[model samples]
Target: MSGTALQQVELVVRTIAQTAVDNEKYFGDLDAVVGDGDFGYSLARGFEKVLEGWDDIDRTDVGAFLKKIGMIVTSRIGGTSGPIWGTAFMKAGISAGPANELSGEQVVAMLRAATDGIKARGQSDVGDKTLLDALVPMTDAIERELASGADHAAVLAVAATTARTAAEATSELVARRGRASYTGERSRGSVDAGAMGVAVIVERISHAWTTEGAS
Candidate 1:
């Protein structure tokens, strides 16, 4: 891979951080309906810490950098959101496996690992109206696009769209996990905050990569 392509990992991190900052309040509002209303704040603080410690991370190794992100998030953010997001990043890092750069296939693998990690950590499934509602669909879309010989940018775009659609659909389902589950039928009309967060991150990632690739 070219040096330019390798730098895309850094771009992904920056994009996610910015997305978290921009949508923090939105996430909080979503959670306030069915959860503790701190989901957005926790995500924002965690990503901000990732940015703050960016200089200390081993940027040359994408896996190590992602692992650092997971560690930082776990340390900075309190509550269940911290461990869930941290586990996702850490599992993605493990899938990345010390690579300095990632291919389209590797990116898919990383996303799958992250989704699996969230499922394991939260003990939630796709119909549970958790982040997996968005993440699993996004990952599946990426895998399909890649299998069809789409490039990284194309795959990411499809995945982002899928995540958004899945997130929107969450409003129709009753929560089966997380604090939202405590609300039972009351949670049916509201979208999952974590799912919305996943949608935002994937959308930002798609936009960032597409813009960078074009440039």
Candidate 2:
């Protein structure tokens, strides 16, 4: 898949929701390992609403669809992750606007926007062992690949790898934000559930584009 290739927003939404659904228990357990067990359930509730609105979303209009998903998720899910992830989506949607086909630059811009939104909403950074940890590396990889003129497949490949690496790196650091932060140094040796979840989302997006033959 080339970065120049087109992808439908509906497909992306479906993939994200499905991934969260499949990993519901996993997320709960991860959070339960260190903090509240509601993260997964809250995320699932939000994604369920997004799934319901899937068919109605404007597939070709990336921005509108993303914005709608963000709003739906934020309203349905009752937790911190909901608003944070939703804001990220909303920011990405605003950045991409109504583009029917996204170029590499557009994709990079969306990722950057999403990261910024998450930061503003969460007040967390990479070393804090939050979603930003995964996202920062993923976006940097995407930007590097985009600058080198890599195709969608290549860009996505780098993103998945970088996200995974960042997610793993979270375990070595003590939590500095959110519920887990309350645990202080006890948060060490535990992977950040939010970081893992974000990694899954990014990896799945990459998989969807490649499997669907976006190139």
Best by TM-score: 1
Please give each candidate's TM-score: 0.93, 0.92
How many clashes show up in model 2? 2
lDDT (Cα, tens digit) per residue for candidate 1, span 59-129: 66788778878888778887998898898888998899778757778988998899889888998888999
State, as a TM-score between 0 and 1, how close model 2 is to the true structure: 0.92
Evaluated at residue 146, the lDDT of candidate 2 is 86
Backbone clash pairs for candidate 1 read none
lDDT of 2 by residue, 139-161 (tens): 89889988998776788888898
TM-score of 1: 0.93
Relative to the true structure, how large is the alpha-carbon lDDT of every model?
Answer: 0.85, 0.83
